[model samples]
Target: MNRKELFEKKPRIKINDKVSYCPTSAAMELIGGKWKSVILTHLIEDKKRYNELRKEIPGITERTLSLQLKQLETDGLVIRKVFTKKPPLKVEYSLTDFGQTLTPILTSIIEWGLRAAETKGEFLLDE
Candidate 1:
């Protein structure tokens, strides 16, 4: 679909009463972004520093990573902690209880994607 058609297709929300867009759809409006899932996947392990996450996920630009991290923090899925230390200092990120709940969901998505790729003989590209 073209840009105009896509924009016109998006569900709109109403404020007070009347016929309004679905709330669940609006929630996905925030969470349904590309890098959100990948950032959450990395945090599923353990608390990681900004640099550590960058190293783990290859090919992600620093700017994009920063944006994703900020968004996740805003959504309350990830908590950012800053520590006072020596020269470089430190910042760490860990999943909140809310974020931990998404692990199984992400695992399922990964499994489904793998199966889909395998059936299409495109799984090799993932490796």
Candidate 2:
């Protein structure tokens, strides 16, 4: 089927009552996009500028990265700082304290992914 038809055919989840979005769902809504996790992972290190992030994450479009960064900022997971300088100005991104709380969770996921990759021989295929 064509893209539109395929999407139209898919079933959508709906809540019958006036239920509010749960914390878990809200969290997912913030970070569940394609680039948020990678962005957060990079921010776990030292603060980085926009260009630095683009270089590190291959295949991400500038527009997508910008949108993800904005979302993270809105969620209070990332702080964006702009410097007023002559010649060339710079923008930097860093994790807020709320965002830092995600470090252990992301680290655990990374560790589990590493173990799973080893067991499944996934790394060998990448070589």
Candidate 3:
């Protein structure tokens, strides 16, 4: 790429008080984590209850899930809703408009995973 193109492609910017020379770093700050992206992948489909998220993500522990959810919420990427006013409370999680912006990135990641599983790695069945 030419110097002018490089300059156009990567302009320094700041978000959430962090300065990033490259935009990818900014994106990673918000979504780069072991479980953050996975949780987001599920949320891309639709809103899910807390238990539902826990169930869908097999290896994630309850505490970890809770923590990740809180972080995502704090980052303005996820929203939580409580429906029930009494016992057997109902809560659901969904992507915010900002979170929805990640749909394409997440989709690309999903596609890459599938391709790698087929071409380079093997998918194993759960015991």
Candidate 4:
């Protein structure tokens, strides 16, 4: 490609050339969907089977859960394992080491949500 064409296709702005628009945007891009963070938080606690995750996270359609899990696996945040040695096949999901890096952030988010819920009268802090 010619220099002019290349420059036109991608500007010289290093920041914009990056995958994310900004630092916060990068974080959001990874886990900003309706249930991405929720799923990640659950995985943080322990590895869970697909059905277990579905039961833990209310109102998430099976399709959405499957799609989200695929996306998470693609993003290297979660690992999916399949076991086929038994009569019924089994699958499980868990966070990878890279995904574990988000624990502090997810914990903070959970704490913030709890406090917000208390203020909104949806939960009691004392309880």
Candidate 5:
């Protein structure tokens, strides 16, 4: 369908108290922030401690990472596990079953990013 017709006929869907005209947009809203998908991509391999995530995601501040993780957990996409009941607490973050469903999608984004960098720009890992 043409762009105008598509937007005109499709009814909006609502979930989690957010209204969205497109499902993709709604999906984006959930994983829309700068670090959410990156965080998810990292967690795809295995659960990680909060500090491990901080080290892997360069440039992300402690506040932002913590906020993103909390949001993800609230959305039922991530689980936070605490293994200690006292000082020197140990915590780990892992994806929920629903979050695992995002594997292909996140992988596709990662692959596309590589393709874009190689074709249009360049990889600066050595620099």
Candidate 6:
């Protein structure tokens, strides 16, 4: 499908009298977890295999990665692809077209984080 059609099919919030709860709440529901946004940040650059994701994301357990990926897939923000032609199966994860629309929001957050780190002296994991 074309870009226009893809955008048209994306989930959107319609504002009307029938609407309830804050729109921010809806966003949080999809990306509120400790690891959801982190996972998304890693995916923003390119599609990554499961092990590649684990290696890139520090402190993430195998179980957490699996669960978060499953949730993201269910929420229509991520696509999971599996290849099974060889001895070891390969699984890749990428953002859906709708998910790519979140680039602005994610980019803003990343910028803010870098600014904060400037004063905070950065965060480093203990070795």
Show where candidate 4 strays beyond 4 Å: 1-18, 124-127
Better of 2 and 6 by lDDT: 6
lDDT, candidates in the order shown: 0.81, 0.83, 0.93, 0.86, 0.94, 0.85
Model 5, range 1-127, lDDT digits (tens) per residue? Answer: 7878877898786767889999788898889978999999999999999999999999999999999999999999999999888889899999999999999999999999999998999877765
The sequence of per-residue lDDT tens digits that candidate 4 reaches over residues 29-83 is 7788899999999998899999999999989999999999998888889999999
For every model shown, what is its TM-score relative to the native structure?
A: 0.74, 0.76, 0.85, 0.80, 0.88, 0.79
lDDT of 3 at 7: 71
Sorted on lDDT, best first, the list reads 5, 3, 4, 6, 2, 1
Error of 2 at 68 (Å): 0.4
Residue-level lDDT of model 6, residues 43-108, one tens digit each, is 999999999999999899999999999989988889999999996888899999988888789989
Candidate 2 lDDT over residue span 1-127, tens digit each: 6868745665343332323245455456667867898899999978999999999999999999998999899889999999987648989999999999999988887899899998976775554
How would you encode candidate 1's per-residue C-alpha lDDT over 60-124 as one tens digit per residue?
89999999899888778899999987757899999999889989987887788889888876834
* Winner by lDDT: 5
After superposing candidate 2, which stretches have Cα over 4 Å from the reference? 1-23, 124-127
- In candidate 4, the residue pairs with backbone N, CA or C atoms under 3 Å apart (3 or more residues apart, or in different chains) clash, namely none
Q: Taking the candidates one at a time, how many backbone clashes does each contain? A: 0, 0, 0, 0, 0, 0
**Model 6 ranges with Cα > 4 A deviation:** 1-20, 121-127
Instruction: Please give the distance, in angstroms, between residue 73's alpha carbon in candidate 5 and its true position after superposition.
Output: 0.2
